[model samples]
Target: MSRKDRDHFNLLCDIGELAALVTGSHNIETFMDSAVRLVSRHLKADVCSIYLYDESAEELILRATIGLNPKAVGRIRMKPGEGLVGATFENLHPIRESAAGGNPLFKYFEEADEERFESFLAVPIQRGVQRIGVLVVQHETADYFSERDVMALKASASQLAGAVENARLLMDLYEATGTHPEVQAPASLQFIRGQSASEGIAQGPITFFKKSHVAFLSGDAHRNENFTVEDFHEAVRQTSRQLADLQSRLAERLPESASLIFTAHFMILKDPKFIDRIVHQIAEGVSPPEAVKNVARHYINVFASSSHAYIREKVSDMEDLAGRILKNLFRRGAEKQENEKGKIVVAAELYPSEILKMASEEVQGVILVKGGITSHVSILARSLKIPLVIADHPHLMHLPEETPVLLDANVGNIYIRPDQEILLQFAGQEAAGKIAAASPSTVCRITQTGDGTRVRLLANINLLSELSTAKELNAEGIGLYRTEFPFIIRPTFPSEEEQYLVYKHLFDEMADREVTIRTLDIAGDKALVYANATSGKNPDLGLRSIRFSLRNRPLFEQQLRAILRAGAEARHLRIMFPMISSLDEFRDARSVVDACVRDLKREDLPHHPGPSIGMMVEVPSVVEIMPALAREADFFSIGTNDFIQYTLAVDRTNEKVADYYRAYHPAVLRGLARVVRAAKTAGREIAVCGEMGHETAYIPFLLGIGIRILSVGPQFLPALRERIAGLTLAEAERHARLLLAEDTLAGALKVLETPTSG
Candidate 1:
């Protein structure tokens, strides 16, 4: 590499570090200023400036600068194609111009003091085609800037775009909540930002729930006396007993999720990977306690750092299992002691049972210091009506005990030591929020729009116990029966008969109503131990869903045969394949089902020869070939979570780029429309069996776009049904039209937030 190239590279690295520093700090203005100053100084430029794109206003406003009139920084604004900076943004390419003022695209802004510079270079700062800003540098001499300079600025801008955009988003949210990311916080108030896992406001003293028992244990972990290998084995046995008891108790309370919630803990306890690793450490002369901690940390770090969100959810389980083992390591029959009643509990993460225990203890709310919202935990907290928030702030661990904490999970914000005014406002809002819960009894048997267009509201069954809730909520049928949950109930995959019993029960419970059972959609990265599954990098797009099924043909056929056997006497049954990306993949999966039928027939076993075969409309490739896919698929169900994730290239659970996971984006909306249109053209049925169906704002749009079926979490059915009751078909069409017309996320968000009316 040339000396100048190396220098430019080093400069980019320095700027990347600077961007990371600014992300944590409140002053984004300082980030912009420092960025411009560094670029100007590094490149020996006369001026450098940052122009942040204001999406709402459709203009790029100068936010920070070096060498220009400082007074004009916040005052100057230009629309796309209005000036050289605007032209950079419009063209979405680096602009390197000598005698820059001579270019017809360049418009002089009198307040900016740019006339002194004869050379200009500007790079459009963007995050995945979303315009963030423009970075500009000027030189005193004409044609002073070279390709190396342009390349360096481009690299810096690319690295800084995410930081700038995140900081910008933080500022906007803060502004909405009457706080400022750019301003210094008061001594009395500390705010922690996180995603709202559950809805509602909660205020109480912050109580840190310590699960790791290392603090209470006496002596060094690596050299503890009397705690030998036998003692560790005994603790493992005792931990198993404790888990069984906990599961039994949880069954009486939260039966729906209790069956397999503790299964993970046991799996970790007995697994050779966990147990043998710890034993190996002890054999290496480390004490049992230290060995356990070492092995647990190894697994926790592995799971937490996984690229896929599925594996990330296992971080909490590892912690929970470690805590259980540690608690039983020395203290036998340790009483469940918690002084967190009516107090806000702050934890790194909580498994489902921990959440339940907190709820039982009358805990006001929970603030998770780390970890993403696991499905089990989120569902349990929501079911228990406890406010939960996942705060990414590092300050959460150091919070003084018993300090007043206000958790506004409804808005996904936490305020530590909130003042009197904030407390009073929340108290008033909480009181106002007491208008009566949406009753399941109010949901119509046949849900319809105000104009009498029938809409089928199905339930997403994750467990057998959820059947009661689905029935009570008037769900028409099981739309997306996630078959993988049954797999997680045991260590290895369930045998054909075991799966049959589960499915048979489901069919019997739902009676004659159609049940769309998705085949095993397990990913390799999750905690569920499978002998056949192999971990890989980027498991989200790796052999998952249908790909995994096809790769393991025997297991795939086993599951299909089980579903078929169970649905032998059932009048209405559907088998759906997840993550179907292509026409050939769908045909391959369907052929397996056909083979399963032939095997069942040849064996003289009773089986459903023709269950409805369908595919989940999740992969982006499926959307393009929808018409052809619809012709082959007996029906189609859109898994909006993965669909939107795939469509936007955003990890739905990732909080860093959570803002980009937009369901209302024109591409996603159009994709859904095209699928629905294709299904109609082919005379095939399609249902949305994802979380989007749970959103009230999205329900109208779904209906507007001719989606007649919405399969949501059973708990959401009541509110969804109520929301649909107030909207006419015509109004929904209008809402859909507005959404389709929107080219920007901001415009789509505005349309979604607006109340529907003709």
Candidate 2:
């Protein structure tokens, strides 16, 4: 390697070593202090600082520092485009300035005492697409930082990203666990809201995630007789063989899981502190088992202490590796650990794969202290049928472990140490829930009100795993099949053939049932990592859903072709366009579907020729032109989720506006009534296909508006059927009339909250 390459390699190794030590600090305060000093010394810089991004405040707060005013650490904050450091974070790129104050964006923080430094360099610490923080280094001499310095620093920042994330997660956990002494638990019944990631109701004892690495505890490392270095090498080889076997086994079950997951474990084995340290100790007359245990325990502490819940999860990996080696030393089999199973898992945050592992272990539900609502983990939780909610209230962490908890993920309410009244209420509802869950095969698929009015019930499916549940619930058909999930979770846009295989499986499963395939609805909250170039300040109002499809016509055409070929022999197929704000957008989308059919015919491909093309009435503008749209569109589906958001001019996912994003808003109810009326007059079939369909509180209102069709998540189909069975069309109409008569939200809510006389 060249001298520069050699230097870069050495710097990265030093960073990894430093991070390992920082991980064992066990708290963010000590982790930060140790981290900045180590980084400054390793890079041979005058100053090293870390600025962690506070997402809620949208500012980068100086978390730790060396060679600057220490008091300014938490006080100095910068927005994404405010200063030099902010520019690097916003652009996800490196910024190096020879004269720091010369840059126009340079805003001096008097408390930081950075004016003395003429050489400044900064880089964004990013893991994949998520920006964790920014790393900055400065020197006292003009033009002191070389291009090599910039490259080396950037590489170091990238290497430290994982460690930084872990420390941050640990910090979040600590704050939640009552690190602040003054914050006390409420004496009375308390309730708080968070973003609901998955929809379900679960009541279980809360189990805080800890001690996952205790499976093979090394009780006080001690010496043994006749243990040598040769035995240690043999144990290493045996562990590799075991990992190989495990890789093969998992590849059969989940091919994607086979990718690079074991790379970290293998790296640990080759790490100098791992095999080398044990071998050195063994050579110094320590027993082979003793040396291995000591080394493994060290790493376990390093991983479990200050590590993020995601990284902390790997403490088990370290223990498992060491356990495999120790088992080889004693010739024993692996042990199983299911401590968190059958309980609600409480953690700061977890990776997507960890969520899968929890599901495999039969975890009843999951509560996150902090995480995004539309993240991959959230999406996976929904697919796996795990109830998930993210409650950011720190008081949650201090609650007594193993206390009976009631989790209502449908609305993001958590009751800790639930009392008698709450328990009784949950029990009555659970009894009804049990009836809905048991003997699904015997439950009739047809839904009818007390007045004998038929309301067609369909499933909204995303994952193939949901197909069986949909079938068991006896869904008449699929109302909205979100195709974006396959695209969002993947590395790139799936080709026509790849999409063909997926859609083909769905068609084969639901052969004779109606399947409405919605085209790629992405670029908003559900963004593709590969397409981060489309990131915007306001994602909801930006180019998303149908706009994204029309902009990328070739890709859209590719997806349409796949859907057509997949459903060639299907009895019923419908193509729906989402986020259709105007009539022109619908026409443009329908034309592409037509073109795909023409090309398939010309190429002699087996493709469905005439699937009903429909548009989602999600955008508020669609309501004003619903009459015009109804004349041309084959069917209409009122997506109440986005409809309420747009009608009230509120962001659906914004926690601050969550109260305003309500289904019972007076304007929202009137809009729904208008759309249903338009569809009825046009003689077009319409369905309430959003959460409103499954929400029993809003079901009567939806039915009252003359919606005879309802579709929701498959898991909800059974409960929804049970709810509709108790309501009559006449009662719903009366309820709707009473609700429409109210002008204010409070008045409308009162009318909707009135208990129905079954």
Candidate 3:
């Protein structure tokens, strides 16, 4: 082979070796040390070192080194732009010098004894836009490093970056939670890391949380196949009853959102395909546990292999239900444990119903070996304000029950076998104080801009419980009442009476205030299994919202009838259709409402004469035809969430391109401006009922654009009210005009960032 070929071959080998070493290395120290040694040897350098960035301190601290004083490893630190290392990290580029010692930027540490090194190469270790640290190599001979060496080192540095980050995060958790390095198991076998589901810090003794444990039987223990089938059906019935009872208990103690968890569970138990699979297995003479395990494993594998995060989370739900059925088959009632206050529950996984059952004022937090943020359990945990971390650490399953541990969900970390100092530090960090203080009642008064621009602040509610919170927050009315909750929380379509009761209760609570009831917005990412809605390849652009409602007219009419019946008792009720891509869809939906009203009148049913009709302007197609839609529709709501997504053609949920889904994009701003202008020209009421409404930075821009109604989460009411009370109409209009003139997202953001005139 040629000399160049040989060098290239060696470089490839070195990269492979480095990857292996970094992957095999157990902890931060070992990983860093292995990296420096491997890089120095490959590049023929005398010294190699790594400096990790400390975000809180805004400094780079020396973590690992070769040919330097060992004592200086943790002692040396440099501020950004202070030395060669800092400059490389801050600039996010590589620095190479043949005469390193004489450079003014080179700061020599006396402890390192590195004055002899004349050539220096430093490169930043980065993960995307985030700069993690700097990697450096020095040679005793001047001009020793070459372009080939730089490329090789950069490749090696990239491999080490993620490992280094994981180590740093683990160390930070140890320090914060007081977990001693010595007590931790081998780095390769101990740490379980997962995404943060909820935010908060919690410390308490660990309790292995499980509803039941069953032993597997070989060949069904030779039990009769007919009996096994009967046993399976009986277990299914019992599991159904258990779920219903749990759902009732949860409904009494938690919000309807929490109780909805069992709804999914109930559906799984009644799923004919799932039950048939189990029955088929039982017919083959296997025990119920084996049948459940077999069927669950198949579904779990299918779901886990799905590319969508939402589908993958279903594995947890399926496994939870399978376990419930298995437990019932074993005739194992709910396992009871002694009352333990402030215990952190640890389990392989937790379902929403399980979380609700365990939720108590005394319960401290939760740790799961496997779960995703989209899981119903995670949603419940967030709603209940419980600290939860999902760590798939290998040691988790082996930890002794009741082992003292610290869980910090804020950063998705758990410290096993914590020390006294860690406990003391945790005690000093008051978790309760982190919660936002309730806005004072004085802020509950009517909100207007400084220049007397009356802006209606309303609440976007999905559950009846939120109505009370909305009232407490002094929301003027319900701007966006998502009506899909009742449908989503049932095994089958909710009856008109069931729907009527829910709507009646909401109307009774809001009393005279205007309540805008949005028809079922399902399909796409929010597909409901009970509704038999199957999400297509391009769900965002497929059957969703009004399209789904129109196709399933019976379901749609049922909801319309319930809404109309409830409107009879309501002083002011508005019915809105979601995802109206064109004028025809809106007119069609309005016609359905008209037909429902006529049907009610023919039956001598007392109903409201008529309700204001509106449609959500979310699709770009609708944006283009808003003038026509505004003329026909009674009002318009800008669903900014989907509007921006559809306009930009970006799926906000995909983390890969999430940064590109900018709400402040110039196109998005122009779109909003065009819609608002059209609504105003047509003399129609327009409101924004999306995440943008609650974002404080967007408030001034929104107000400036002539948007008079803003609907946000109930919790955001106080802060939004306070924000509106500080803005003036004139200044907002000026800011809006300035924002519209901008041609880029950055420029638009700058306009919003600037203080608006009060």
State which candidate, 2 or 3, has the greater lDDT.
2
Query: What's model 1's overall lDDT?
Result: 0.74
Q: Predict model 2's lDDT versus the native.
A: 0.74
Compose the digit string of candidate 2's lDDT tens values, residues 598-677: 98787555789899999888888887899999989999898887888788897765566666677888888998999999
Which lDDT tens digits does candidate 1 get at residues 1-758? 45566556436544224523443232456656777877788889999998887665788888889989999976898899888899899988899998898998888888878798999999988643256789999988999998768767876775566456544433332222222233333455588778888887888998777523324332244354557787787777776666656555554544333333544454455444467778888989887887877887777676666554433555666776676677676564354533467799888766544676565457899998665553546655765678999878666766667888899998899988998999999888877667454422354788887888899989987667678889887899999888876565442455454466678778888876888999988663233443345546766777778887899786787689889977988888899999999999999999999999998787556789899899999988887799889879999999998898889998766677877888899999999999899998999998998878888889889998889998988878878888898889989998899999999988989999997742
Candidates' C-alpha lDDT = 0.74, 0.74, 0.72
Candidate 2 Cα misplacement greater than 4 A, ranges: 1-344, 349-354, 360-362, 370-380, 395-442, 523-525, 755-757
lDDT of 3 by residue, 57-112 (tens): 78898889998888999789999898999999988778999998778998989988
TM values, all candidates: 0.60, 0.59, 0.60
Q: In model 1, which regions exceed 4 Å deviation? A: 1-193, 200-211, 214-241, 252-366, 369-387, 400-408, 415-441, 488-491, 524-536, 604-606, 741-754
| Reference-based TM-score, model 3 | 0.60
Model 1 RMSD in Å is: 25.2
RMSD to true structure for each model, in Å: 25.2, 16.0, 28.3
Q: RMSD in angstroms, candidate 2? A: 16.0
Q: Provide the lDDT at 11 for model 3.
A: 50
